[model samples]
Target: MSLLGATALVAVALDQWVKWLCTEHLTEGRPVKVLGGLIYLSLLRNSGAAFSFGSAHTWIFPVVTLIVIGWIAWMATRLRSIPWAVSLGLVLGGAFGNLGDRLFRSPGPFQGHVVDMISLFEPYGQHFAVFNIADSCLTVGVALAVLLELTGRQRDGSKAVKKAT
Candidate 1:
């Protein structure tokens, strides 16, 4: 899982750097178009998961994030395939990206909010949920992992038995 470790570190660095830029340059709740009206950087402080779900349970996210981090670390020891490594790296990085906020950002530790700034879907009048690079990485990584699974590729570099048609 050396590849996974390296990829995860890189992902975390990139995610955190992007978030830092958003925190330093973008104003919260203020939308600034970057690539026309379709894409904008709209800063937000999320105390919950996607779409601001479970905002009331801010403390729980940090705990869950920690669990996820630990789980990824455990998985790293056995990771083999590139797809698996990349996928896990993205998940791990995204988890830590937000975890960093939960552990260090404003309000209080383990109750801090995630920093989101990227937004899309302006052609429809209403933008999609505010998100960040970490979220993007997580979505892509998960999709890739699912694709790998469906294609009979196992995380440990083995192929699954093909079922009779």
Candidate 2:
């Protein structure tokens, strides 16, 4: 539990710090190569769902983000016996990071765009939206969680735990 907690805290802090750097330094739509083009730092503010979808819907994005975060928090409390506590924790942390930005960063409550900096993909073509560390954690965490759920393996590689014990 401590390990998961510590990792979650680290993820949140790292995500926030990088986002701050992005907003402070990078220009919107400009890319700064980090590894000869394999990776770059590009500033982007996404007001919508992942990959910048539903951007025009405005009000809906924040509401859904809030709902998702709320559900994640509730699930966290009920997550005992699941072996993927750390992964779940990461997901929660990442969700909170982006949610925090949406709630308090520029623009307004539930209206602020998430600061994205880390960009990794091929150039000379359409690329994935620029995203931050928190996004990475959320992606990996969700993928892992879903995989576990589908395979019936918890974080410990055991079956879903029985909490009634």
Candidate 3:
């Protein structure tokens, strides 16, 4: 399998497993301190986008995720660089993880809630929104993609050279 495929599968598996563990061990809407209040594991069923944005419109995310997945699949056709593979894989897997919930989890088809459990800065009153493994993977992947772009790294193993003035 290609590196993207392999890494995507790995990310998907890990995301799902971590979500399962959170569902089993974490209490819904109740924070469990993991680092003396610095970090907490608290189950939150996000019905919409990140930070609970648009929670009233839970149906939109699945459609967006589908589009993203399709775009990634199309992009994979020309993937060559290791960085691109890794970034694409992370994106693909994270998308699938949330997509699976929207498809298979409760509340109805294409309107399911995403499982989030990790929180940072709670002790400082920041109460940062809780997130899940899939979110982290997606964030990392997107960050890497941005870094690659800024560094002129191309997806097909070619450098994006600057034009002469």
Which candidate ranks first by lDDT, i.e. highest? 3
Worst 10 residues of 2 by lDDT: 121-130
Pick out the ten consecutive residues of candidate 3 with the lowest summed lDDT.
121-130
For residues 38-131, could you state the per-residue lDDT of candidate 1 as single tens digits?
Answer: 7888878899888899999999998987888898888878777888999988888888888899889988898899988877855212647888
- Measured by TM-score, the strongest candidate is 3
* Order of the predicted models by lDDT, top scorer first: 3, 1, 2
**Which structure is stronger by lDDT: 2 or 3?**
3
TM-score of each: 0.92, 0.80, 0.94
**Candidate 3 stretches greater than 4 Å from native:** 123-126
Per-residue alpha-carbon lDDT of candidate 2 for residues 13-34, written as tens digits (9 for 90 to 100): 9999888887888787677887
Tens digits of per-residue lDDT, candidate 3, 105-159, equal 8898888989878889672225566787888889999999999999999999899
Collision count for each candidate, in order: 0, 3, 0
lDDT agreement with native, every candidate: 0.84, 0.74, 0.86
Off by over 4 Å in 1: 123-125
Question: Residue 86 in candidate 1 has what lDDT?
Answer: 90
Question: Model 1: what TM-score?
Answer: 0.92
